[model samples]
Structure formats: structure tokens, C-alpha cells
Target: MVAEKITQCMKPHGEEGYQTIENMNENHKEISDFAFECVNVGENDKILDIGCGGGVNIEKFLKLTSGNVDGLDYSGVSVNASIRQNQNAVESGRCNVIQADVSDMPIDDESYDLVSAFETIYFWPDIANTFKEVSRIIKPQGQFMIAQGTDGNHPDDELWLSTVEGMSVYTADELEKYLLNAGFKSVKSFKKENDYILIVIAKK
Candidate 1:
């Protein structure tokens, strides 16, 4: 059912789980660098972080932007944890966290300068629908970036990797094709860690 297993795996284990993920280097470096490349945030920009999970990326983006950043996750537990973790940023109105699915965010069209999804799209049952939602919320020429863990380099793709129930690993070309089909322009991709992870940057 669309890999609801992801929600289960990330159901939250207090700060320890979030802390572990934040501290681990198994697959974050590339995704982090990709963030810097894609958004290239400015003082006046507004951004969105879809499937924000533990809100680490929102926290990172806050350091890069003087503008507002909004985070949305399908899991209420995740949203609460993210809020708790990024409370100061939220209180300062520089960041926000909400519980919502990737395919139906409670945001308006043409609302953001950038949209990012970090290691989360694989769980979406309808990747195209998810992109459609993301496209609707970004302004013209705005950027959309997807950061995913590399299945090949995940260190567990053979035994423990989690993926959409019946879907196979998506090649960079396949991902780009879908994004283009979804109406994204200027699509480009970057591979990290020997093809273990891929970052796709596209414009709306």
C-alpha cells in the first residue's frame, strides 16, 4: 500500500532515532551538498520541504535563508517531532512544520521559490502525482530538488533496503523522464557515492 512500511520504520523513537540519522554519514553528505546546489537560497526566498521527516533539512535551510521555509510530512508524529526539534526556528517564523502527504500539501500554487524532497519520494505510491503537487506550489522558474538514498550504495539494498512495495529501483534517466513528463524543465541529475544516491534538480 504505497510502502506504508516507511512510516512504520520512521514512526519515531524519540530524539535518539532522529539524532542517529542526523549524525550518520552513511548517505547524508551528498544530499546535503545537493541542497546547497539546488536551492541556492537568498535572503528573500520562500521554500518548501516536502516529506520533511525529522526536519533536519529545514534546519539546514534556515542557516542558508533569511526568508521563510515550510516543512510538510505525511506523518503527524514526524511533524510533531520536527516541530519540537526546530522549535526556535518555528517560533521565529523562519520555518514551519505541518503534517500532510506529498500529493496533497495544504499550500497554494506559485507559492515558493524552491521545493525539496529528501530521501522520501520512494515511499510515495504515485510519484507523478507527488511531482504534480510540488509543481503547483512553486513559482515560475523556481527549482525542485529530490534527494534520495542510493539503493546500490545503501549497504543493505540486498538484504535490508526499504522501497515502494512492488517498484524496482529507479535509474537516473527514469527519474528525469518522469519529472520532465510532469512538466518540469531544465532537468538535470547528480549521482553521489558511486550511484548509491541521486539528486535531481529541475525547474518549474
Candidate 2:
């Protein structure tokens, strides 16, 4: 029951899911901040944030860029929450959020300069296919950033892995291998302190 509840919150479904996403936004601030610091966002670059929960990152991305930012999530609840959170940007046409899965995103080819996935890839059904989709939407030399609180080597990850169905934390090296297999030309990873928090930067 505990695992089921956690999984539901991770993907979120209804009113309760909205609250969970809000909680996640508050809790994930540190990793997100660290991830952004590891890269530079061009003033006029289109960005797509995958698995965008509560639209917090999307809001931040809007402030960081003069160009547009888009968000995609598999959960309708998350989609609604992100829309509500970034209503002003959406109204002004600077941001757009959609309900969709990562493996088959409904975005145009080479449409974005950067793509981000934060604390969400663990739930993707097929990481490889999803990476391919992410690659498709990115322009030449575009970057894909993945930020996670767990680097797959954390001692606590075993507990979460046992409890959470379909949750698979990965090491920076493992992610780098997959990213390269998906057509990314180069990949680099960063660590925050001694914690399991890892940020991967992949260029296509």
C-alpha cells in the first residue's frame, strides 16, 4: 500500500496528486538549483522541460530565457497544476504545458534548444525510447539535462527501489551510456557535495 501510494504521487492522479506535486516542488528545490548552475541558458533559446511537475521549473526557465519554454508530463493532474502555476506565462504565449508521455512526445522536430528531465526519468517506461524522443525535439547541438536526487548508488535507493514499482535509479555512468546510445554526441555528469544528487548534461 505504501508503494502504491508513493507511485501514485510520483505520477499523480487527482486532487491529492496536485498537493503531492506542490510538495515535490518545494522539496526538490536544492537539486534543481544545483542542476541549473551546471549549465548556461541562452537568453533567446527555446526549452522543453519533460516531466514538469507543478510547473515550477517551467516558471524558472521562463525567467531565464527571452524565448519560449514548454512543458510535458504524463499525468493530467501534473499538467493542470503546471498550467495553473504558470497561467500568466501561458496567457502571454511564453509558456505551454501539455499532457503526454515521454516515449511519444507531440512536439515538432528540432523544436527546442534544450530539454530537461528532473527527478522523473525513473518512472519512464522505456528510458531509451524516451531519450530518442527527447533527441528528436532538440535542434542540432542541443543539450539535454537530467537532474536527480538519487545517483542509483545511494544506500537509501535500495529501499525506494524495493518499495516503488517501476522506479529505477541510475548512476551517472549508466545514464551517460544510454544517452550516447540515443545519439547524444557527448555526456558529462556533476555531483552536488557528497550526496547522491547527480546532474547529467548531454549534447546532441
Candidate 3:
């Protein structure tokens, strides 16, 4: 029953799912901040945040750039929550939140200066292919940033893996290999001291 509940993190829906997103927004903040520090955000750089969840990160991105920020999530509940969180940006045409899968996005080719995935890729299917899709939407010399709470070496990794359905964790090395295979020109990774936080940046 606990594992089933945990599965809500995969494709959140309903009230429980909504609550899960809210919790994640708060829980993932520190790791997200670490990620922000590793990437450069230009005032006019457009950004697309995958698995935008409650849209808290989108709110932060709006402050960092004068250009638009968009969000994509497969969960409709998450989409609604994100839209609500960034309602003003949406109203002013500064943001668009779409409910769509990572493997097949509706964005135009080379559309963004930066693409980010935060605490979300563990639930992705065929991750390498998804990276290709991410690459497709990023402009040349643009970047893809991935932030995770684990590098597959956390103390509770096994427990979470056993409990959450379809969830997987990868080390920085493994992820780097996949990113390179997906056509990224270069990849750099950072790990927090004495912590499980991992940030990987891939340039196209």
C-alpha cells in the first residue's frame, strides 16, 4: 500500500497527487538551488523546465530571465497546479505549461536556451531517447541540466527503489554516458559534499 502511494510520484493525479507535488516543491528546493548555482542564466535566455510539478522552479526561473519560461509535465494535475502557481506569467504570455510526455514533446526545434529536469527523470522511460528529444528543443550551444536528490548511492536508495514503482536512479557517470550517446557535445557533473545531491549539465 505504501509503495502504491509512492507511485503517485510517477504520474501524479487526484488529491493525493496534488499533495505530493506540493510536498515535492518544498522538499526539492535545496537540490534545485544547488542546480541553479551550477548553470548560467542569461537575462534574455529562454528556458523550458521538464516535469515542472508545482511550478515553484518556474517561478524562480521567471525572476532570473527577462525571456519566457515554459513548463512541461505528463501529469494533468501537475499541469494544473503549475498553471495556478504561475498564473500571472501565463496571463501575460511569459509562460506556458503543457501536459505532455518527455519522449514526445510539442515544442519547436531549437527553441530554448536552457532545458532543466529536476527530481523527475527517475520516472522517465527510455531516458536516452528522451534526452534526444530534449536536445532537439535546445538551441545550439544551449544546455540541459538535471538535478537529482540521489546519485544511486544514497543510504535509502534500496528502500525507495523497492517501494516506488518504475523509479530508477543513475550515477553521474552512467548519466554522462547516456547524455553523450544522445548527442550532447559535453557533460559536466557536480556532487554535493557528504550528500546524495547530483547535478549534471550537458551542452548541445
Best by lDDT: 3
- Model 3 TM-score (2 dp): 0.97
Residues 60-95, model 3: lDDT tens digits: 999999999999999999999999999999999999
* C-alpha positional error of residue 120 in candidate 3 after TM-score superposition, expressed in Å: 0.6
Query: Candidate 1 at 40: error in angstroms?
Result: 2.3
Candidate 1: tens digits of C-alpha lDDT, residues 136-183: 899999989888766334666544345424333566787788888888
TM-score of each: 0.81, 0.96, 0.97
Name the runs in model 1 displaced over 4 angstroms.
1-7, 10-30, 37-39, 151-168, 193-195
Error of 1 at 104 (Å): 1.3
Score residue 196 of candidate 2 by CA lDDT: 82
lDDT of 3 at 179: 95
Report lDDT (Cα) of residue 33, candidate 2. Answer: 95
Whole-model lDDT, candidate 1? 0.72
Q: Against the hidden true structure, what lDDT does model 2 obtain?
A: 0.90
lDDT of 2 at 58: 95
Q: Write the per-residue lDDT of candidate 2 for residues 103-155, one digit (tens) a residue.
A: 98888899999999999999987888778888999999999999999888888
RMSD of each: 4.0, 1.5, 1.4
